[model samples]
Target chain A: MANVSNETRPLSPHLQVYRLPLNAKLSILHRITGVALAFAAILIVWYFLALATGPEYFETASAVLTSWFGILVFTLSTVALWLHFANGVRHLVWDTGSHLGQKASNRSAMIGLAFMVVMTIITLWIAIGG
Target chain B: MRFLTDRKRVEGLGSAKQGTGHFWEQRLSAIALLFLVPLFVLPFAYNLGDGYEEVRAAYAHPVNAVIAIAFFVTVSLHFFQGVQVVIEDYVHGRLGMILIIAMRLLSTLFALIGAYAVIRISLGA
Candidate 1:
């Protein structure tokens, strides 16, 4: 590809220039939750590796999960879980050719946010001694 | 000097068009995330007793193991695609681009390895 001169080209809607609309915010949240889940991959590896080595190893793994840091990570993972799921459902609805209009788009975004909050609360409840 | 410089430039895409692959993969991962998220969330509600053997057995169950593996794989792939698009849009400088690429590659590899390990342990290997 040829290098184009920035000066000659008309201004484009770059990240800063682009107004963050409902759809845009939801899109960014999806990416953020994705990154969060990527970090949770470490827990998955730890669990599996512990299981492979048997009961003693598994206890060591479980103990870490019960600690403060483990609980924090677990809580974060739950939030990521709900956020991704709710946003994903929104994406699926959009895929079905619905919710493209302004009113419906805002509604979907609100619904997604509400669902994520409710789900996260329920998840944490279950995680912490519920 | 673009197309005139190379015959490869004449081809629109590579040998295979990958639009469908990417689309379906994204959807499949999304669906997996939907179910896996709930299953993972549910397990944390009830405290697993403080017994090593009990906890081990709970995880050793083929179903639990399978679901965990599925969650690991789907979550990782979803993250991989999401981060790639973000990096492509936001990364501009040479150093930034390199960092983005490195991040994506490592994230994918880590996800893949974690998923593989989960499957092996879940299957009782």
Candidate 2:
């Protein structure tokens, strides 16, 4: 039998052992939201295709898209889009050799999150009509 | 007899060398989208509740059609690059290669479809 014991393994910093800082957490979320937005992009393409296909197809898409469940998914994706976009802008700023300090990075991350929330609310308000 | 230094000859032979191009393309597309996304999304959000004809007419505008096409193209390219990085980081071996290829094909197909749809709408067809 092979010796397989947890005590023999060296400990590494992991989610259970260490708490990630806000900036680190947001950075991870940025990648996740980016992936989410990618899937949403596929849905957008399908919607456009439906629109171009004909009135019947467009009506079907519109109906499904405006349903309660559909709107819920759409709103969630929209929020992800804003978060990804805001964090991406923060990344671009860092790429320019500025704002690389921890303080600046943390501050910008907070601002990015706030911006995402405000933008998502505003866009959704405009979209849902009120 | 060679005039080139060893360092110069080996400059682009490593992994970091190849990553520069991918990184720059992502940044360029990101910048393009930073502007074009707002342009596309604003009109799109405004037209959310519009009917078939109204939405079609909105897309028919030259500026709207052009921006929509640009947005589709840039976003697809960016999405492909971003997902490729994700796959490279998390996936390995034959599966990673297959996934990367699939991502490339899917993003390209979606981009083309989106562009064609915009063109069709703009043409009043």
Q: lDDT by residue for model 1 over A1-130, one digit each (tens)?
A: 3867657778877886788887888787788777777666677577657767777887888788777878787778777777778888988888889888999988988988899899888767665554
Q: Which parts of model 1 are misplaced by more than 4 Å?
A: A1-23, B1-17, B44-50, B92-108, B123-125
lDDT for every model? 0.71, 0.86
Alpha-carbon DockQ of candidate 1: 0.37
- Residue B14, candidate 1: Cα error in Å is 8.5
Per TM-score, the best of the predicted structures is 2
- Categorize the docking of model 1: acceptable
Q: Relative to the unseen true structure, what is the C-alpha lDDT of residue A31 in candidate 2, on a scale of 0 to 100? A: 84
Q: After superposition, how far is residue B69 of candidate 2 from its true place, in Å?
A: 0.9
Q: Write the per-residue lDDT of candidate 2 for residues A67-104, one digit (tens) a residue.
A: 88668777998888888889899999999999999999
Off by over 4 Å in 2: A1-14, B5-12, B16-19
Residue range with the least summed lDDT across 10 consecutive positions in model 1 chain A = A121-130
Q: List, residue by residue over B1-125, the lDDT tens digit for candidate 2.
A: 99999878876766756636788899999999899888987677777657999888888899999998999999899989999999999999999999999999988998899999999988977
